[model samples]
Structure formats: structure tokens, C-alpha cells
Target chain A: MRSHRDFARGFRESLAGGPAPQNATAQDPAEIERRFDVYRNNVAHGLTQALARHFPAIERLLGADCFRGLARAYIAEHPPRTPVLTEWGGAFPAYLADEPSLQSLSYLPDVARIEWARSRAYHAADSEPIAPERLQETATRAGTDLCLDLHPSVQVLQLLTPAGSIWASQQPGGPAPPRAKEWRPETLLIARRGISHVITSVVRSSTGRFVSALRAGDTVARARDRAGADFDLNAALLLLVENALIVGAGIETGDES
Target chain B: MTLPRKAGLGFKPEHFPAITETKPDLGFFEIHAENYMGAGGMPHAMLERLRADYALSVHGVGLSIGGPDPLDRDHLARLKLLCDRYDPESFSEHLAWASHGGVWMHDLLPLPYTAETLSLICDHVDEVQEHLGRRMLLENPATYVLFDDSDIPETEFLTEISQRTGCGLLLDVNNVFVSCVNHRQDPRAYLEAFPLNRVGEIHLAGHEEEELPSGPLLIDSHGREVAEPVWALYAEIVSKTGPLPSLIEWDNDVPDFATLMAEAKRASMILSGDHHALTS
Candidate 1:
């Protein structure tokens, strides 16, 4: 019997178009090659389909052929580390950022970041959103000690390019994204709308910072101060409440929980 | 709970709304266990709704039950979490391995049928049954290649695993046809040797054929309607097994809910047909 170690190595090598392992069969060499090609094609094709599903905007922007090529390269270098494909593409945005071929499309990586965040938000834990009335009651009671806990699905992306707009444009009903005349930074907030949908919107940089500070365990007063005068704390709070992005409210006794 | 002796379809999220609205008559809905292993959100919500309407079979594709390395404990833990949450009527995994050297290939790769692997697979099955606290049905693989070192016949190998680990079998008729044709063997003969008494569920799916100098090679691509020959094989099995909770698996290029239900309806017809024939 062939040792599993030997079979694993040979099969892995054969998937990359190497010679079929000797122990695989005693059939004609041509039959072996063709049969083994199915396994090779299955791996490449299956993983590529998974990537396309997770990052449809990337596939659309790059076109089908270009996306397949890119996906092949990424699969070759970073095959899924786990069986859960939802967790498999976390490194893809970084992979795109480091790719020399895609350097011309500088915003592609940031757009990919937004796509990944949307996927994450779609699968994030369910939480009951704190209602505006409850939030106000808590604020009145806790006063300056009030702290906010963002929903588990809420994610803020502070991007170097207007990727929030780019990702949104590629969505099913979104407008065609503008062709960039100049590179500018963009901030986006991602959160689940109920359990069945995810919402992505471009937001002011100050609002992004405000959410970030609150996510980092800052009190409502402190996070609002960090957002500077330009940040409308009320508006940000309203957005969070309306989007069901606030999961909890507590009093911070100078100790981060 | 056991899956009803009727027809079911692989649960696709795109059809969630349609399924919920119409509440199609299905025996059970089978979901890939790995798809719901995430922390939460829409997948769970959709599944929760469907679970109320139908029995569920949590089929796992990522357990790597036949891999050379030790079974992934974290993956098992995740499966446990899902099974505990859903308490599915049935749980199943493939006889093939999908991961090696920490890299998951996302496809079920074949393994040599030998004493070495037989023992390895039995141990893994035992561990899974012990961990999940229930018997898991092991589905046979659809392979395009054979191994020179395989001393045990695939049927005997599966039977031995079941005997050793006390696990039931998931007889995928399409797989039997695909492997038998790809290997130039007879599908009926393979089914004859299969342990039908221990089979808890049955699977029927579509396959694509590629011309080869030797003959036509059948690829188990679950992307279309169930083919006639595969349906014939399924009918033969149903005749023998008496309508054991069959499922129509159309994973890729999934048609709309009506098309999927059409496939399941055909299976239901055959199941009822066989029951009538037997009783008469």
C-alpha cells in the first residue's frame, strides 16, 4: 500500500500539473492523466467559484476572465486554511494589495476590503439593537459615564480610496461608481439590517472615528470628544440606532469591560 | 428523529424565500454543515425558519474523515455546535478526504482502499460519533481514478467501517453510478454489494460525461437535473431500500425552487411507485 504521506505529496504535486503518482493506478498513462485532471480541475474550479461567490464585485470589476486568472493565482498561493470557506478569504484583500499586477488599480484592494467586511457582517452574531428610547433613558441615567457597545456585525472601514462608493455601486441596485479623477480617502460603515440583509454606506470620517473609539471601549462622552467638533454625536448615535448597530449600553466606571 | 421516507432537496439560501412562502412538501432539507458554522446571521435565521417546516439532514463536507492527519478537533467542535443548535434528524459526511497538510482543497479527493486507510477511517468515524453523540451516515465517494494498492473492495471497506464504528451509510446512487462507470464496472453489482440495511438515507444527483478513448468518464457534477441512468439506479435502490429518506442534490447552477421541487417530485413518485409495487 502507498503511504498516505507519499500519496499526499504526489497528489499535491500532480494538482499543479506534475506527473501522476505511480501508485495511483496501473492503467494506461493517458487514462491516468485524464482522470487525474478531473481532481485538478475540481480543486481549481471549486475554490475559484467560492471566491467569486464571496467577492462578486471584484469579479465584476476585473471581468470574468481576469477574475479567474486572479483567483487562480490567489488559490495557488493561499489555498483555504479551513473547511469553512466563509473564513477562508480574509487574506484575499491583503493578497490583492501585495500583487504587482494589480498595482495599477490601487483602489481594488480597498474595495475588496469592503467586500470582505460585508461578508463578515452578513455572518456576524445576532444581537438585539438598543432602541433610541432606551438609549436616551440610559443616557439620562448614566450621564457622562455612559458607554456604548456596537452590534457584533458593525464594522468601520477607513479606506485610502473611495472604496465604499465603489463597492456600493457594484451592488444589485446601486448606481454606477464614478471613475476616479483623483484618489481620496473614504470611510464606510457596515452593519446587518435584521438577520437577512447587510447595509453598507459611506460616512463622514469623523463618524468613522467616533465608531472606532466607541468600539475600542471609550465612553460615549470620550468617543464624542475624540470625534472632534465636526462630529455630530447625535447624528452618529441616530445612525447607529436606526441601523440597529447598537447592541448594548452600560456605565463605564473608569474600567474597560 | 428520522428523516421521513419521502423526497428532499439540498437547501440553497437563494430559495429560502420561495421555500418559506410556499412551504414545499419535502421529506427533509439537507444543508452542508460547514456552511452554517459561522457565528450567526442570515444563514442561521433562514435555516431556523426552514427547520420548523421540515426535517433536516446536516451533511458535512469538510470533516476530512479519511485524511492521513488526525481529525481536526476545532472542526469537530464547530459541527457539534451546529448539531446541538439544530438537532438535525440525520448527519452525514463523505468517505473521501478534502484537506492535507493544513490546506483544505474544498474537493473530495479519493483514497486508496487498504487496511491502513480502513483502520484510519474507522477511528475517525468512531471519534466523530463519540464527539457528536450520534451515529453519522458515511457517503461513498465518486472517484475518477483507482489505486494499485487497494486490497479491499470499496463495499467491503465501507461495511467494515460501519461494523467497526456502528455508523449508518448514506448511499448516494449517483456516486455509485459515477464511480462504477468511471472505473468501467457495473453499477448494479456495486449496489448489490452495498449494505442497504444499514443505509439511513439516499442521495441522487446529476453528473456530466466527458468522452475518453477508454469510454465516457462521468464527473459527479451536481449542477443539473438528475440524468435518466442515475434515476434508474436510484429506482433500483429504492426498490430494495423501500423509500429511505431520499434527497435530490443539485448544488451547482441550482435551478429555481420550482425546478428543484420538480426533481424532488420525481423521486417521490418513484418512492411511492416502489411502495405500491412492493405492497401489491
Candidate 2:
């Protein structure tokens, strides 16, 4: 009997575009290659379906056949390391960003990134948002020491293209995409509105800086300062509150006023 | 723990709203264990809702029980957490392998039936049962190709695994028929050799047929409703087992909730029909 290690290596190789495993057999000699192709087709077909589900916007941006070609290539080059299909496509955006064929669509990678972030946010841990009054009280008491805790699902992405709008336009009933000349770099925010859906949008650059600071454990005052003068702290706070992103608030120092 | 001996449908997220609103009369809903491995989300929300109203069978598609490598510790821990959270009525995984050398193929691959392979499978099953503190059902695999080195019959290999590990069997009738047709064996003979008393559940699904030069090659696609021949084979099993928890599995190109319920209705009719035969 052939060792399993050798068999597995051969099998994986065959699936990834190599020769059929020599030990594999069919009832008829003519059927060996045809039979072996079943596994190959399945691995390619299944992962491609998973990828399409993960990045529907990308699929729409590139037609089905074109998307499938890229999907097959991606599957061969960077097969998933885990069984969790949701987690399998994290590396896709980066892969897209590096692909020479997609250089013309510079915004494609960021669009993929936002989609990935939305998926991650959709599956993030659940937590209760701190009450509006709690934020007011914490700001008054802690002042510079106030540090806000964001919800587990909160994610901010700073991209070089108008990827948020691109992703949004691809969504059902979403607003139309910005004109090519009107397109500009945008900061995106993704958070779960409830268990059923995620809130993904392009936020002001200042708001992105503020949320990024808070997510990095900055004090509320520091995060606010990072947003600069044009930043509307009220709007930023409202965004967090309305979307249920602020889970808790605390003082950076152990001092409780 | 065994699920109710009634027909059920494989849960799809797209059917969440319909299922919750209508609350279809089902014995249970089966979900792929890996799908819920995420920390929290609509998957959990839907599952929690369904779990409150119906029995759940946590079917795993990624444990790779027949692999050469050791069972993934982190994956096993996640499975333990999910099982604990849901407290499902039944837990099952495939006898075939999926992941190997840390790369998940995402498709259940075949295994050579040998003593060495049998022992390996038994060990993996034992580990899973011990880790989860529960008995699990191991399902048969649908293979497209055979291995030259396989000396043991697939049925006997499964029987030995059950006898040694005390794990129950999940008889997937579609797989039995697909493998039988692919290998030019008799599905009835295969069932005769199967340990029917140890079968805790039964699965029926669709397959894609390709006309090979020698004969028909059926791939277990699970893309549509159960075929007529598969229904006949399932009836045969139900007649013998008196109605295991039969599931209508439609994974790919999943139809609407009504379509799935219709299929489940067919399976339920068979189960109840067999029950009547046994009683009267």
C-alpha cells in the first residue's frame, strides 16, 4: 500500500495542476484521468463559489468568466489554510492589489478590502453599546484621561481610492458610484447595525483618524485632537452611538472622579 | 444523543427570514459545523432561533477524520465550543478527509480502505468523541475513483471503525448509490453489509451524472432535489432501520424554502410509510 503522506502529496499536487496520482484507479483505463478530474473540478469549483460569495462586488466588477479565471488562479496560488470559508478570502484584496492585470482598476483592491472588513464585522463578537449618558458622564469626569472602547465589530479602513463608494454602488439599492474624475481617496468604516446586517460607509477623513486612534487605545481627548479643527466631534460620536459601535468608556488612568 | 426520527432540511442562511417567519414543521435542521465556527453573527442568530424551535444536527464538514495528520487542536476546540453553545441533538462528520498538511481543500477527499487507514480513522473518531464528551456519527463518503492499494471493502472498514470506536454511523444513501454506480458495485449489497443497527441518521441528496466511456459516473453535487433512484434506495434503508433522522441536503444552487420543505415532506412520507408497515 502506498503511504498516506505520498498519496496526499500526489493528490494535492494533481488538484493544483499536476499529474494524476499514480495510485488512483478507475474500472476502465480510459476513465482514470476523467475520474481524477472530478476532485480537481470540485476543489476549484467549490472554492470559487466561496470566493464569489465573499466578494460579490469583485464578481460584479469583473464578469463571471473573468472572475472565475482569477478565482481559479487564486485558489491554486493561495489555497485556504483553514476550513472556515469565511476566513479564507482575507488575503484576496492584497492578492488583487499585487496583480498586474488589475492595475488599470486601481480601486479594485480597496473595494475588495472593504468587502472583507464587512464580512469580518458581520461575524465579530457581540457587545452592548454604552449608553449616551454614560459617554457624557465619562467625558465630564475623566477629561483627558477618558478612553472609549469600541464595539468588537468596529473596523476602519484608509484606502488610496474611492473603494467604499465602489463597493457601495455594487450593493443592491446602493447609491451610484462617483465619476472617475470625481473619485478620491476615502476612509471607510464598517460596523454591525444589528445581528441581521452591517453598516458599511465612507466616513470623513477626520472621523476615520478619530476612530482609528480610539481603536488603538488612545484617550478620548487624544482621539478628538487627532480629528483636527474641521472634525465634528458630535457627528463622530453620533456615528458611533447610532451604529452601536461604542461598547464601553473608561479613564486611561485608574483615577475615578 | 439522537435526533428525532423525522425528516429535516439542511439550513441555508438565505432561507433564514422565511424559516423564522413561517416556522416550518421540521424534525430538525442540520448545519455545517464550520459555518458556525465564526465568533458571532447572523449565523449564530439564525441558529439560536432555530435551535429554540427545532432539534439541530451539527454536521461537521472539515474534521478530516481519515487524514494522515493529527486532528487540528484549535479546530477541535472551536467545535467543542459550538457544540456546548448549541447543545445540538446530534453531531456528525464525514469519514473522508478535507484538510491535509495545513491546506484545506474544502472538498471531502477519498481514503484508501486498509487496516492502517481503519486504525487511523478509529483513533481520530475516538479523539473527537472524547474531546466533545459525546458519541458522533461518521458518514460514508462518495468516491469518484478507487485506490489500487485498498484491500478492505469500504463497508467493512466503516463497520470496523464503529465497532472499535463505538461511534454510530450516518448512512448517506446518495453516497452509497454514487459510489456503487462509480465503482460498478451493487448498492443493495453495500447496504446489506452496512451496520444498519448502528445507523443514527440517513442523508439523501442530488448527484451530477456524467456519461463515462465504461458507464455512468455520478458526482455527489448536492445541488438539487434528491433523485428518484436515490429515493428508492433511501426507502430501502428506511424499511430496514424503521426511520432514522433523514435529511434532505441541498447545498449548491439552493432552492427556495418551500422547495426544500417539499423534499423533506417526501422523506417524511417514506419514514411514516415504513412505520406503518412495521406497526400493522
Q: What is the C-alpha RMSD of each candidate to the true structure, in Å?
A: 2.3, 2.4
Can you list each candidate's DockQ?
Answer: 0.78, 0.85
Q: Which ten residues in a row have the lowest lDDT in candidate 2 chain A?
A: A248-257
Model 1 C-alpha lDDT per residue in residues A24-120, reported as the tens digit of each score: 7724557898888999999999899899988999999999999999899999888899999988888899999999999998889999988899999
Q: Which candidate is the best by lDDT?
A: 2
- For model 2, residues A64-146, the per-residue Cα lDDT tens digits are 99999999989878999998898999899999989999999999999898888988998998787788888889878987898
Q: What local distance difference test score does each model get?
A: 0.89, 0.90
TM, every model: 0.97, 0.97
Task: List TM-scores of chain B, every candidate.
Answer: 0.97, 0.97
Model 1: what TM-score?
0.97
- Tens-place lDDT per residue, model 2, B1-280, is 6799999999998998899899888899999999998888788988999999999999998888988989999999999999999999999999898888999999999978888889889999999999999999999999999988899999899999999999999999999999999999999999999999999999999999999889999999999878888888888787777978999999988999999998898888889874332222
Q: How does residue B202 of candidate 1 score in lDDT?
A: 92
Per-prediction backbone clash count = 0, 0
